[model samples]
Target chain A: MSEELDTGFFADWLRAAATAIDREAAHLTELDSPIGDADHGSNLQRGFTAVQTALAKEPQETPGALLLFTGRQLISTVGGASGPLYGTLLRRTGKALGDAAAVPLPELAAALRGAADAVAQLGGAAPGDATMLDALYPALDALDAGSAPGDAFPAAARAAAEGAEATVPMQARKGRASYLGERSVGHEDPGAASTALLFEALATAYGEGA
Target chain B: MAGGEQVGIVLVSHSSEVADSAAQLARELGGGEAAPVVGAGGAAGGGTGTSSERIAEAAHAVDSGAGVALLADLGSAVLTVKSLLAEGDQLPEPARLVDAPLVEGAIAAAVTASGGADLDAVAAAAEEAYQYRKV
Candidate 1:
């Protein structure tokens, strides 16, 4: 099988992301109900719908534009810590994409790394903060450590899932969950769960037995 | 308020789902005021997939005639917008971004933009809030 990251695939990736979030929005909200605002599902659903609308209307000329547009859509539509943190990650990563509509696997890995780094900086937290970084950071690290996308993606997904689950034992220190203190311990971090969903979407799209 | 004009708000986040939801909440919270929200973010992986191109794309989306305020989530993204401005990038004039607590900054910026405040003022408020959140 040929391995290439093209514009069509990139567009499909956004669609996949939207679909994944929509499918899991309810679950995310359910998790949040226990330890944070119970609006995770509603929040992500509305934001992705806006992204779908924005992308459909403008139809980016390049893959970079597609990613950038997606990022911008999230930033413009979403609020809360996830809004800015996620927005910053995409915006910075989109900026890194430049004019190339298609990228190699290595390049894609690098781009993912750039995005994860931006998000980490924005949150001011690390992998164990019971935040999305717990999932995202490990994924990037795996990719940076020379794992292939097919291999790296699933590994990242597993890592993310584990990371989200791990949040169950840890206290929150970032975002709204931080307000809950010890109460935040039992519940899975909503952002990490969402991050896991993102990886699952990608894994389904690109990491399926490649 | 220009007799009930629509305020163009720029939304920034990491994922499409999160950004979309945040924008919807903003609209719902905005009540009767019509808010035209725009969005941007890093790729889904959590870091910025690209930088200049995405900011430029978002900048083009802004309406120059209406007030536009940018709200972002993370540190580098704020820096990305700053870099875009520093480079004399091709973006709508009279636009600014808020680099503060993501939700608070966004709500404040949207409110100010919908009313009498210009994009600069809204952005300033958001930025100030962002600084406060860091501490």
Candidate 2:
């Protein structure tokens, strides 16, 4: 098997993400009800559904194209902070991938780091702000620690899940949740939960490849 | 209006009514022939969210080649506009995102654009609105 992932792998990864988000949408929204607008689950579901439909309608030739199109779909379909934040993550990562048909593990990791950083920059939310960065940064760290491309996804997924759980005690410093001040504590961050789902989807897709 | 082409302004908000009213007020403040102001607000089906597609359409609608200055209500609105601008070839050049209070910033930006101010000047005017104090 190739050491790098092609467009097919990218497609599978998105499909897995959509399915996982669909299954967990209610849980995500439930988490949001306390601190956020209570629409994280439905917003992501709509965005990912649009992504799925777009990919099915017009298959992209390269992984970069696939991710870029997916990001656009999310941005247009989802109507919240997550849409732009996640869309920027995917779009920036895709742009960093630079038209590559297949991306090596190291390149993918670097791309993901760039994507996460872009999300942070766009939202102006740092670690401990009770946002997706809590999960995303840990996932990136785990990926960075992985010596092989195949080793990264599973580790990242595990780290992301733990990170999402970690957000429960944090106080939001950005977004609508921030308006709650101290009241935001005790609730798991919906963004972090959705981000964990994304990593989980990545792990599932890569595990299948292995 | 007596100078070069006016910069365009796009107001992004989660509520369609807020965006529309804000735009109307800004237009009135800038007088007739103010640079075109477009309101891109609300989700596809409406009710409290921002649509990037709507934002893109608004941007295109307001683009007069002088450039565009964007004012957003909240976090997601800002992020969406930034994402749209990040699309390399899709949006016009000289586009910029101003970090400022939405209503005030839009009004300030509209007045500046109406005078045919350049992109930077219009953006600076919007940003300066953050310093306005009534007390």
Candidate 3:
């Protein structure tokens, strides 16, 4: 594949994300049932499906445009805090692309970093807080440390998975789970789990090849 | 900037009924339709969830150039309003997320805005409501 990614590549990744979210919606909801509102799965599934539908109707021309459009859809459709948080993630990353026709992998890396930072700032949490940052930060860290895109993606996916798993034992420090105090431990964070899924979807998208 | 014009109020809640009811009650206490008061509640498709789009729309609708003050209930409601504020240009210019209780804050904010208070004064009234003794 080319070093630079186009709108089609991201659209593919988002479609893969939607499918994966649908398949794993039950598990996501179950994870949330323990420490969250138990609506993460449904909300994300609905948001991604909306993205899929919108992408089909009016395909965005550039990578930034596609992500920006997707972000707005999620913000409008998903509802709840997840909507704004996820929307900001995509929109911030997309905005960093700056209407480039195709974005290089390095650019994507930087964008994801900015996106994660934006999420942290917006959510008022950090990597160990057991939010999506747990998965996202690790994935980006792995991506930055790797040499090849292929190796980086699988590594990132693995790192995200491990990060999500690590959250199981962490005491919640933010969001609704924090309200649970000590009881929040032992349950894997649903947002972290979903972040892992997002990385997995990215890996799958890259593996499909143009 | 304009103090003579009443500040607008937008009540955000997890449920449509909750926000509307608060707005209704606050209106009664606020001298009946003295200022623009809007209830932006629930997800876009209805049901549970705080819709940023809905809140933004409500804020814009109630805005009278005097500035809009937002009061939200519960977790996501506060987060959503903050997210909108961070996004820049989404909310009406000079909009503020007032830190206060949902019902009580809305009541105080509405009363203050209805009396033609400026945006800061309206927000202050809402925040001050938290200090009232319920017992």
Candidate 4:
């Protein structure tokens, strides 16, 4: 079994995250149907599916490569606003991982911060935009606040969930949902939902891998 | 039930490329050597692709008594699979519809399919394995 901090476990974590996305893709689409293109789930499903396929074929040698390849898959396979935003997040984080064979806690934290910043750069949205950034931003904030990796993950997960829920009342400021104006206010953001799942998978991984 | 013998897992997707991606994952995770994950997908339109029927026919032709699992992406691809299977007088194995996380479900299904288990078992595992968690 791989430890939470082990290089092997990072691969497992990415696979697990892929699984979670697969499971929730339709639900996310359902949430978006009312306010957006109704393809959020499908879009993400396709992207992550590509990531899984690519990773399986080549099997990245390092955690950084895993994140980089996964991010590239999303950018290529997925269309719409979510693709680039999510793509930048992973790519930037992968870049942050540098050339290290394995990442320590501090490096991982820095990578996450890099990911969050990249997301903001790509999406041009802040913490309250009811986008994936909403959940991801808070999660990174929580992570940066400094707790054990085990403790920080759960906190980040919780923050993400809250951020997703917070989208319920805010006006959409970006993405297809933004086109809806007030109509988008009541609907949950699909990107945010998937974002929440990423954190959730992370939280669960603390024990499974840790 | 594929006549209760060696079964092939059928994968359908909106595009041939997407379906192939699913096949790639299965090949990696499941089929080590002995068993292979059978795959099919529509090109562009759901029902138009010959790949879906050809793959199923190939599987049946190889071993008529074998069971084949059907996994469809969404849209008309499902109907195409149904028509192809109906012609063979072979009802699809307990099938799964995976729209979101398309790759994950396909990979999981392929892994289990090639793991030497029945279609029902593979589908169940694939479906259950997709649950999103918050830790």
The estimated TM-scores of all candidates read: 0.63, 0.95, 0.94, 0.59
Best by DockQ: 2
Can you give the DockQ of every candidate in the order shown? 0.07, 0.83, 0.69, 0.02
Question: Weakest 10 consecutive residues, lDDT, candidate 4 chain B?
Answer: B43-52
Candidate 3, residues A119-157, lDDT tens digits: the string is: 898888887888899999999999898776677888999
Tens-digit per-residue lDDT, B1-135, candidate 4? 333343466566656667767777767876564245555655322433323334455345423234555666643344345433433343444333333345676667666655566756766766765685548
Q: Evaluated on chain B only, what are the TM-scores of all the candidate structures, in order? A: 0.71, 0.92, 0.94, 0.65
Off by over 4 Å in 4: A1-4, B1-135
Comparing 2 and 3 on DockQ, the stronger one: 2
The sequence of per-residue lDDT tens digits that candidate 1 reaches over residues A1-210 is 246667776776677878999989889989988887676776677777888898778888877777777876665455444665666666676778788857776787788778887777656787788988888876666655645567766777787788788888989897667887888888889988988888777677774424
- B3: Cα error in model 2, Å: 6.9
lDDT of 3 by residue, B49-81 (tens): 788888999999988788999999876788789
Which candidate, 2 or 4, has the higher lDDT? 2
Clashes of each: 64, 0, 0, 6
Superposition error at A22 for model 2 (Å): 0.4
Better of 1 and 2 by TM-score: 2
Stretches > 4 Å off in candidate 3? B1-4, B133-135
DockQ category of candidate 2: high
- Can you tell me which runs of candidate 2 are displaced by over 4 Å? B1-4
| Shift of residue A201 alpha carbon in model 3, Å | 0.5
